[model samples]
Target: MSLVNLEAVHKRFGEFEVLSNINLSVSEGEIVAIIGRSGSGKSTLLRCINGLEPVQQGRITVDGTEVTAANADLNNLRQRVGMVFQSYNLFPHLSVERNVTLALKVVRKTPYAEARDIAHEVITKVGLADKFGAYPDELSGGQQQRVAIARSLAMGPKVMLFDEITSALDPELVGEVLRVLEALAADGMTMLLVTHEMKFAKTVGNRTVFMHEGRIHEEGDSRETLEHPRTPELTGFLDAVLH
Candidate 1:
C-alpha cells in the first residue's frame, strides 16, 4: 500500500479553486519532488498531506491514516508527517536544543532528559551538533534552516514534507541545507518536497511531479521526466527553469 495517497483531491478558497482533481501517491522510502510555478498548488498539496489544510473534496491517506476524515487525530497525523517551510520558524529566544525539543517535551510529554537526547541526535544528523547551545539569532540562514529540519526530524516522523525550504537561503548557504536533505534521502526516509532547485530535484528525487494550473501536468521517473519532458507544459517549464 502507498504510504501517502491523494485521490481526487480538490481545494478551494472563497470560490477560487486552488487544487483540482489531484491524484497522487507516494511509496515508503520514496522521495517525490514536486515542481511548479508559483500558485500551482504545490505547497497547498503538501499542507493537505500533513493535515494543515482541509480539502473541499476527496480523500488523503498517509501511513494508513485517513487525513481527511472528520475524526482524524490531526495532532497525531502531524507528528507522523513532518513539514519544513522556506522560513526556519525557530524560536529566537530559545537555544537550538530547546527549539528542537520543545515539541517533544510539550506535545509528546517526553521527559526533558529524553527530549534533550533526541534533540542532540537529530541536531547531529543535520550537522549541527556543536550548535545545540546556540540561539537561532546566532546561526546563519542555512544553519537556522538545518535546525528547523532537525526540529521536525526529532519527532521521528514517518514522512517529511518540504516546501521550498531553501528558497530563503543565500546561494552560498543553500548547499548545506540541501546536503542534509540528501543525507536523509540516502537514509531511505520518505519525503515529498516542493522545490525550485531543479538539479536537486533531479538528483535526489526518485519521482518527479510537475504541477500546472492547479493540476498534475506530468509525472514519472525523475531523471526521465526532467530530462525528457513529454508534455508541452512540462517542456516549457523545464526550458524556463533550466536556462
Candidate 2:
C-alpha cells in the first residue's frame, strides 16, 4: 500500500510556479531518489509532502491523513514523516544525546530516561553510538549529519524524507552518511530523498525520479533509468552531471 500519495499537486510563489501537475505515489518500504538540476522544485516537493509548504491545488495524503484538507492535523502528520536536510541543524550547546532526544521529550512527552534510551538505539543505527556524550561541534561534518539522521530516526517515523543530505559534506565524508542510508534501506525504512549522488541513487534507490521544469520528467527503476535514459532531458542531465 502507498504510504504517501500526491495527486495533481500544484505549488506557486505568487506569479512563479514551482510545481505543476505533480502526481506521485510511494509505497511502504520503498526508496525513491529524486534527481534534477537546480530550480526544478525537487526540495519544494519534499517540503510539500511534509506540510512545510502548502500546495495551491490538488491533494496530498500521508499514511491516510489528507494533508491538503483544512482540518488536517499537520503536527501529527509531521510526526509520522521525518525530514533530514543538507545542513545538520544540531543545537550547538546540546550534547548529541540531548540533541536527538529534545523533540522526543518536548513533542512526544517522552521522559528523559526513555528518550535517552531511544537516542542510544538510533545513534547506534547511524554508527555514532560512541559520540552520545559529545557536543555537535566536537564531531566531524559527517558525524554531525549522522546524528541528524539519528534524530529523525528517533522520532519513529513511518517515512523519511531527505533533502540533499550529503550536499554540504566534504567528498571524503559523504560515504559515511551514504553508508548509514544504505543500512536504513537494508532495514526496509521507507525513504524519499532528493540527491545528486547518481551512483548511490542507482545502487540504493528502488526507483529514480528525474525532475525538470518543476515536474517529474522521467522515472523508473534506478539502474535502468540511469543507464538507459529514454528522454533527451534525462540523457543530457546524466551526461552533464556525471561526466
Candidate 3:
C-alpha cells in the first residue's frame, strides 16, 4: 500500500469547487512535487492532507489512518504529518530554539530537557545551530524559514508537506530553503511540495504531478512529464515558464 493516498477527494467552498476527483499516492521515501498555475488547488491539497481543511468527499489516508473521516483522531494524525507554509510563521517573540521546542513540550508532552535536545538536533540539521538563541526578527528571511523547517522536523513526522515555501522569499534566499529540502530529499524523507519552481520540480522530484483548474491533469516520472508534457495545458505551461 502507498504511504500516502488520496482517492477521489473533493473539496468545495460554497458554490466554488476547489478540488475535483483528486487521486494521488506517494510511496515511502518518495519525493513528489505538485506544480500548476495559480489557483490550481495545489496548496488546498496539502491543507487537506494536514487536516487544516476538511474534504467534502472521498478518502485521504496517510500511513493507515483516514484523514477525511470525522471520527479519526486528528491530533494523532497531525503528529505524523508536518506542514511548512510559504510564510515562515515563526513567533517573533520566541527564540529559534523555543519556537522549535514549543510543540514538543506542549503537544507531545516531552520534558523540557528532552525537547531542548531534540530542538538542538533539528536546528543543527537545518544548518542553524549557531542561531538557536536568536529571535525570528533577528535572522535573515532564509534563515528564519530554515528555522521553521527545523521546527516541523522536531516533531518527528513521517511525511512533510511544503506549500510553496519559496514563493515568498527573495530569489537568492530561495536557494537556501531549497538546499535544506534537497538534503532532506537525499536522506529519503517522504515529502510532497507544492511549487511553481519548474526546474527543481523537474530535476529533484521522483515524480511530478501537474494540476490544472481543480484536478490533476497529468503525472508521471519527473523527467518525462516535464520534458514531454502530454497535454496542451501542461505543454503551454512549460513553454510559458521555461521559454
Report the number of the highest-lDDT candidate: 2
Runs in model 3 deviating more than 4 A are none
lDDT of 2 by residue, 1-243 (tens): 699999999999998999999999999999999999999999999999989999999999999999999999999988889999989888899999999999999999998899989999999989898999999999999999999999989999999999999999999999999999999999999999999999999999999999999999999999999999999999999999998
The candidate 2 region of ten consecutive residues with least summed lDDT is 82-91
Rank candidates by lDDT, best first.
2, 1, 3
RMSD of 2: 0.8
Q: Rate the local accuracy (lDDT) of all candidates.
A: 0.95, 0.95, 0.93
User: Which stretches of model 1 miss by more than 4 angstroms?
Assistant: none
Steric clash pairs (candidate 1): none
User: Per-residue lDDT tens digits of candidate 1, residues 1-243?
Assistant: 899999999999878889999999999999999999999999999999988889999999999899999999999888988899899889999999999999999999999999999999999999999998999999999999999999999999999999999999999999999999999999999999999999999999999999998899999999999999999989888889888
TM-scores for every candidate against the unseen true structure: 0.98, 0.98, 0.98
For 1-243, candidate 3 gives per-residue lDDT tens digits of 799999999999898899999999999999899999899898999999978999999999998999988898889898899889899899888999999999999999999999999999999999999998999999988998899999999999999999999999999999989999999999889999998888899778999999998999999999999999899999998888777
